[model samples]
Target: MNERLRFVDPTALMHLSRGLTFNPLRSAEVLDDVLAAFDEKNGYVSDVQAWVRGGGLQNGPCPTLPSGRIVADVTETMNAERKVLHAAAILKLEREAGIAPGVFLSMVSPTLDVGMRVELPMRALLKGNLPLEGTYTVYLHVLMTSDGRDLVYYGITKRGWSLRFQEHTRSAISRESHRLFARTLRDLTAARARELHGVLDERPKLRGLITTICATGLCHGEALDVEEAMVEKYSLASKHANGLNMIPGGAAGLRAAQRFKGTH
Candidate 1:
């Protein structure tokens, strides 16, 4: 007799009525049919679309139906109609070589000529290491062409120091530098940054600038893990005659609103 423990076997009649009589095969078939119906019914759409349709546009474009709504192709709203990231080649190499984290963060200065090219020389911070432990060092060189269309890439030291991974830079890159670059493009396109620049034209708010920067990066397919922390540290406050309250989700929401409007 252990305390806080009790067990009782059900009577045969009770077990028959409650648990033993059920047909698991039929029950599974019914569940499968329900899930299929749910998927087929287009249940993934949100209520926001319906709400927009219901609300009449007063100051901006006309809103009658799908035709009169202020709708446009979202792809057209992006800087280049699509944002692409190139991690495949680097990932492949890393996989083959069994590289880990915290390996290298070195610089490879480029040579600007008929085309931009760089020859990287990594000092190999760690050697004779296991793959599943820490970050591995991989030398990389990227060049943004003058035309802003082409990218020149070179991955050095895996083989020879000067062997180039031609056109490898065309792959979409996920890095802080790329994040900042995408932010600039979105700001120029959405006119959000320009608006802020015009309004606070004299002395700009530093935190506002930072939030905008982070938000723009998020919009252009980048994520900063500490975004919430950044907002908590930098957002503004409002006070009424009786009391003061912070706007819920302030800077982050503003950024999301801009994103929803295809501004980002």
Candidate 2:
């Protein structure tokens, strides 16, 4: 649960109630009618024009005057001029008021809806598990051997770093030769290299030799651009160094290389 949960201000509610000149006897009914309308729209934008038109929310003919209808009308007016509100607050209000989660979420905006989905895993991660749902810097998993040289066995994923780390470890341990990283390990083994020899003998221990570099966030087109940049920067195009990249970064890198080749 978010500790920062906020509710609709009483002052705002009171002002709205007054604008509708709601009947004291049927205040609940009026509130219900107005809320139902909002629920129908999954909550409108703060500046929604449709809400200002004063349509919908009529329950039926009543002998005790149309106080509920008036309240609905007032709500529409207030909603049109009201500032934007977070969907979480509205959801919290509905929950506290004994409304079902299904109904509350059903009317939430698409953005808020995605946020709600993202929130669950994020909260769980904050409690000491691997994190989720945030912009992450893609990185390179480079192995530094006993010698001064390094070998990049895997490119980091744009998704969760920890999750990707686990995936690499799992794939390497399982000796999935089809995977690029695993294929690199096989190649290194076959070469009988002394410097980083037996590096992949115990795949789990490889994590210690591997260092994750270039952690970044939310800029330069996020991880994809960064990953491509790193790949190009460290590429052993004509060098004697060993790199595990099967593909040459992204499409942009390929295009740039092609242009260079054409000019030369």
Candidate 3:
């Protein structure tokens, strides 16, 4: 009865309407009412009412309703209803929260991994949400010796893992000092340098040696925390023979060399 009309995605509304076909005569009216309810409540509804109206429950006792439907049938019906509601919810969120549809879809999907989730804020930024800037993960890239016995380098980037890797390769091949990883590899012993050179020279080889260890969907401070933790845990320093990290992690990495003298 609340007359507040909330915006709903047309596609999502269509999906919800299609899902109500079991009771065709009242489907249109039910869909209208459902939309109205969502609108009035800022796009949310009571779970029990949603289930009942979504065909997971029906009238009558005994063999007419509860006794007539098997567990699998009820579960299937409930799942179908849930999908419709989820789609509607996502659409509502998109409209009200200004969330990009792709980002909402990724959040609703069941299989999104940590890396993908961590990338959502960046996606939002690309979609013109400037407020999310500097809050996404600064992913860590670990490159290890061919035998995987030791880590060869530790890298962190807010740009992207693949882009940073390409930069490392380019800087190494061009003998440029822009990328510390490439510079470190270039400074290693001949045999070790050649091994890493071959790896960086080939895209597939470079990718194979790289692994993303920690990805977080937190602010820059959290990302720095993760980077520092990884650096300490992995001992990514020149003192570690196999480590290729030129300096310590986080802001400390940017300090002048004088500060770390005789500190080990």
TM-score for each model: 0.16, 0.35, 0.38
- Tens-digit per-residue lDDT, 1-264, candidate 2: 122212122222222122222232233334334444554664432112232222211322111111111112211111455543222222333223321121111122221111111111111111122222344445455544334455674354445444565566567557774756565544443332322443344232221233333433333355556667667667433332557665566556467669879999
State each model's CA lDDT, in order: 0.23, 0.36, 0.37
Descending-lDDT candidate ranking: 3, 2, 1
Clashes of 1: 10
Question: Where does candidate 2 stray beyond 4 Å?
Answer: 1-132, 146-148, 153-156, 185-208, 236-240, 251-264
lDDT of 2: 0.36
Cα error of candidate 2 at position 69, Å: 68
| Top TM-score model | 3
Model 3, position 119: C-alpha lDDT score: 17
Query: Candidate 3 at 181: error in angstroms?
Result: 2.2
Q: How accurate locally is residue 41 in candidate 3, as Cα lDDT from 0 to 100?
A: 56
Give the per-residue lDDT digits (tens) of candidate 3, residues 187-244. 4322344444454432112212333324423466666676666665665665675566
RMSD of each: 28.4, 22.4, 17.3
lDDT (C-alpha) at residue 179 in model 1:
30
Query: In candidate 2, what residue range of length 10 has the lowest lDDT sum?
Result: 114-123
Which candidate number has the best lDDT?
3
